[model samples]
Every structure is written in C-alpha cells, then in structure tokens.
Target: MTLEATDVSHGYGNETVFDGVSLSVSTGEVVAIIGPSGVGKSTLLRLLALFDAPDRGTISYDGEDVWRQPEGRRLEHRRRIGMVFQDASLFDASVRRNAAYGLRVRQSWPERIRHGFAQLVGEQNGTGDAVEALETVGLADKVDQDADSLSGGEAQRVAFARALAYDPEILLLDEPTSDLDPRNTAVIEDAVLQARDRGIGVVVATHDMHQARRVADRTAVLLGDEILEVDRTERVFDDPRDDRTRQFIDGELIY
Candidate 1:
C-alpha cells in the first residue's frame, strides 16, 4: 500500500503551519521527516493519522481518498493507520488494558481472538491480542503489570503495542524515542524495525539525524512551512540538493 499526500496544507487560527506539503510512503518502507523545533513535524504526523484534516489538500491511502470520508469511516481508517506520540502515552491500567484499549473502545464488546497462535504471532503474551501486542514490543512478561509501573521505554513499548494490536496498515511515529534514555531508545528502535518487517508503512518524525540514518529508507526535511526535500535516507544526508537542507544538517537553523 502507498500513502500519498497531495498538496496537503494545514494551519491553526490565522497562522499557516504547513502549506503545499507533499510526500508518500510505500509498504515495508520507513520515511523519516526531520526538521527544527516547532516546524510542524508533529503536526504533519497528526494530519497523516487523520486526527485532524488538512484544510486544503488530499491524503490518499491505497488510492482511497481519506479526507473525504465520513467521520465514522474516517475513525475506522485512523485505526488502520496508527499514530504514536512523542510522550508515548500509556494508561495507568494494566498492560492488557493498554494494549486492548483501542479494540475495547472501538468495538463496544471486548475484542475476541480466535486462536492462541494469533496472539503469539503478534508477539504478545498468553492473553491473546493484548498480550501479543506487548510481546511484539518485548513486553510479554509484563503483560499483567500496571502501565504506571513501567519505565519510560517500557511505557512507550506498551503504547506502541496498543497501536499494533489494531492491525494498522500504516504506523505514524512522532519522535517515538524522545523521552527514552539511550538504552530504552535502542529497544524501541528495534520494535519499530520489527513492525516494518511486518509490511507496515512507517513514518517517523524526528530531530535525530542518526536515528534517521539508522531506520529511514527515505528522509524528508520539513522547513519554512514546507517539505524542503524528500529522498533516499543516504542521499538526503550525503547529497542534500537544497541549501536549507545542507545548512540544517550542518547545525544551522532553517527556521
């Protein structure tokens, strides 16, 4: 599947945050959007996740027009395309609840799994989807533990598991490891790679150059309310055609 953003533009109140932004993500590929602070990296993620709409453009997922869909269908599409935040928000409830929260809330009745392998396949614990989600993030043993008891990295992993449990088609990450220490950041990075292996289109918004080099197949630089450049990860880093990109990579602020 391919996610295409055609001329997507958004703003708040009277200020324009993003305009004329265009990008795409193909299946099994990870695209990293990098930029300076307050440059709409997270805003783009929110727009991608359908948390809000792009006021002037179209976001197409697998050829279907996402923005034109009705609210209920849009909600369904949002689940299929997941979003992870910078804070990695996790509930105080048990790991089971945290992982299964989407399913529980979306379906009204608890989500049911047909077999045990289903859970194990998703890298979860013995509890099925919820546990499997945790296992995917290497949290099988802590499936019954409280979300509050988890460390920063562990909580993020649980939050990621929640997104995975929904069987999302595309995974959107906004500075996924920003809150983690180096060790935990490595852990979450591994989890993300695993998710990609499962054929999901992953889009990560980050300020970390090394992280982009490590996981991104392609990289896009967001600056001056636009996507300055989008290309292969190495190409973007080593041969940035844009002057702004060169300066930004050299530690000069673009905005």
Candidate 2:
C-alpha cells in the first residue's frame, strides 16, 4: 500500500506554511522529513496523517482519495494509521493502560463485550498486546508503573509502544527523539527500523541529520514551505541537487 500527497498546500489563515509539496511512502519504507525549525515538517506530517485537509492538494491512500471518502471510511482508514506527537502525550495512568488506550478505544462494542468476558476469565485482551509492544520498546518490566512516574525517555517509549500496539499499517513520528539522550534515541530508532521490517510504512520528521541518515530509506528536505528535494538518503545528504539542501546539510543554512 502507498500513501501520497500531490501538490499539497496548507496554511493558518493568511500565513502560508507550505505549498505544492509532494511526497509518497509505501509499506516497508521509511521516509524522513528533514528541515530546520518552522519549515512545516510537522504540518506536512499532519496532512499526511489526514488530521487536516490541505488548501490545495490531494492525499491518497492505496489509490483512493482520502478527502473524498465518507467520514466512516476516513475514520476506518485512520484506525490503520498511528501517529506519535512530539511531546509523547500519555494518560495519567499505568504504562499498560496508556499503551492499550488506542486499541481499546478502537474496539467495536461487540468486540469490547467479548474482550470484557475474556478479561473476566483472566484471559489476555488489549493489555496483552500492550505488554507485547512494551516489551518491543524495552519497557516490559514497567507495565504497571504509573506513566507520570517515568522519565521523559521512558514516557516517549510508552507513547511509541501505544502506537505499535495498534498494529497500524503506517506510522507517523514527529520529532520523537528531539529531547532524548543517545541511549533513548537509539532505542526508538531501533524500534522504528523493526517496525519497517514488519512492512509498515514509516514517516519520520526530524531535525537531526544523523538520525535521519540512520533511519530513512529516502529523505525529503523541506525549506521555504516546500519540499526542496526528495531522493535516496545517501544522495540527499552526499550529493544534493539543490544548493539549499547542501547548505542545510552542512549547517550553513538557517531560517
């Protein structure tokens, strides 16, 4: 499956954030959006996630135009996608609860009832999936810990685990490790790669060049509210077609 945006333009009121930007990602691929601050990387991600509509453009998933679909269809489509915000927002509850929240909320009433019965019998349900995700992110032992009691990195890991537990077909990450230490960053990066290996399309927005280089199969450089370049990761960093891309890569450009 593929997710694509063609000639997308967006803004807040009169302020144009980006325009005529195009990008695509397919299952098992990791695409990194790299740019300086205020370059609209996060905005682009939101648009791709179908959280917002663009002023002028089309976003398609699996060859169907998302904006033209019915609300029910859109909601169903969204359920197959997962997004992790920059702040790694979580509930003021146990790690297991936080991780399972999405899966629980997405359950149909009949499914919920069945799960409830299963729970009463001491059977595994959403919490089982949540714990498995936690294990993937190295938080298995902290399943019962209060989310609020965890460190910043641990909280982010929980947020990631939450997304993974949903078993999304695509994952969108926005500056997930911007404030994390190297060890935490490495953990998240490894998780992302593992997810891709499982055939989930992954889109990551990051200002850290090294992180982008490490994770992305392809990279897109955003500047001036538009995508300046999109190419193989090595080519974008080592032999950019746009001078601005080169300048940004060398730390010689800033907004």
Candidate 3:
C-alpha cells in the first residue's frame, strides 16, 4: 500500500546523519526529498530502496517491516523497488544487454526457463522488454548500440530504461537529471510522470527546488540530519510553516 520509514537513523561510525526521520509515499504519488549537499538525501534514498539498512528504525512496505524479513524475502522485496542514481552507471555492452542484465540476475523461474529456451534456439537477443523500456525513454533505436558510446543524456536514459524493464512498484531517483540539459531533463521528467501514472510510488532526492516543484506531489525538506518539513509541494514552496523551510526556499540558507 505504501513505502515508509519511521524514526530511521543512520551514520558511519561516530558520524551521525539523521535521527528519527520518518517519511512515506503512497502508490501513484511522487515525493521529493530536497536539501543541499551532504544532507543525507542519497543515504535516505539508499535506505528506502533497501540498499542499506538503518542503524535504527524500520523501513516498511504495506505495514510490514522489510528489514526484519528473512534474507531471501528481503531480496524479493528489493526487486519491487528500483533505484536510479545520478551517475546511472551502465555496462559497455549493447543497450539491450545492459537493460536486461538486472532481470537476468533477478531471474524468476519463468525468466530462467525462457533464457534456457532462448539459448537452445540460438536466439540470444530476445530484447522485447528492454526495447520497450528504451522506447519509454525515447531510445528505442539505440537498443543495439553500445552503451558506452552513448552521450551523457542518452546513457542516463538507458539507465532509467534498464530500471523500468523490471516494472518495479517503487522507483527511487537520486538527482537523476542533475547533469542534463533542459531538453533531456524534460524527457526524464516525462518518463517519471509516466511511471507515476502506472501506479509506481516515486521518491526523488534532489537539490533543485524547481524540479521538485514540477515533479513532486509532496516535498520533504531535509537539513542536517532532520526533515524540517514535509507538505504538499505548492504549500512547501509558497507558504512553508517552518522558517527554515522558508529560508531554504528563498535561498537565504545554503544547505
């Protein structure tokens, strides 16, 4: 029903990042976490996506604590969530191969069976799903191209396409369009909106307030180990209740 974190706390060694941080995103909603650099935005995204466990607190899906699940169950749970980083690292193989790699690694019985069948038939390039994912990101024609030869924007889109190929229930984006031009950013934003339309809960960690305002239904402002406020995007931008939120919105505070 929803993805949530309650009183989540984490740090490396003696350094504390945040404590008692709670956040949630319901299906079909996009929640943006915005803050200046080194404010634990990426760390929180990692926790939400189950890439890292919190030192304290729980991350739950549909009221069940995922971290407490058995390791196999946890891995299964992670399959329902996909994460896209700012860098969007891609392999040097063809885009189709790179996009389908995740599915191969997370192979369900049917996928394994199908892959075996494909190998038996000498049809190694059954990339229908990957091609469709690329089409979603406006790169259908690039499926057979070498991923390493792509431009920055194209490569990032391919990374997003790869995540989409699995059709995850939740999509965690960490500044996915930070390095793109306006056109490419718009393309990525459209892809995100399309994902939301398909009932995927989206959590975006961004430093760009404008991007948050554009894509987020709600926004959580993170600062120095705390979420100062989380509210509807318009309200958070136009009439924040917290002075710190207002200051951050007004560019008075830098981080």
TM-score, per-candidate, Cα-based: 0.90, 0.95, 0.94
- Of 1 and 3, the candidate ahead on TM-score is 3
Total colliding residue pairs, candidate 1: 6
Q: Which candidate is the best by TM-score?
A: 2
lDDT for residue 38 in candidate 2, whole number 0-100:
76
Give model 2 RMSD, 1 decimal: 1.7
For model 3, how does the per-residue alpha-carbon lDDT over 1-255 read when each residue is reduced to its tens digit?
689999999999999999999999888999999999889999999999998899999999889899889999888888888889999799878888888876777777887788868856867655677888899999999877898889999999999999988888999999999999999999999999999999988999999999999999999999878999999999999999989888988999965
Give the poorly placed runs of model 3, Cα more than 4 Å off: 108-126
Model 1 score (lDDT): 0.84
Model 1's TM-score against the true structure: 0.90
Q: Alpha carbon lDDT of residue 94, candidate 1?
A: 80
If the candidates were sorted by their lDDT against the true structure, best first, what order would they fall in? 2, 3, 1
Instruction: Please report how far candidate 2 places residue 170 from its true position, in Å.
Output: 0.7
**In model 1, where is the ten-residue run with the lowest total lDDT?**
108-117
Q: Candidate 2 or 3, higher lDDT?
A: 2
lDDT of 3 at 25: 89
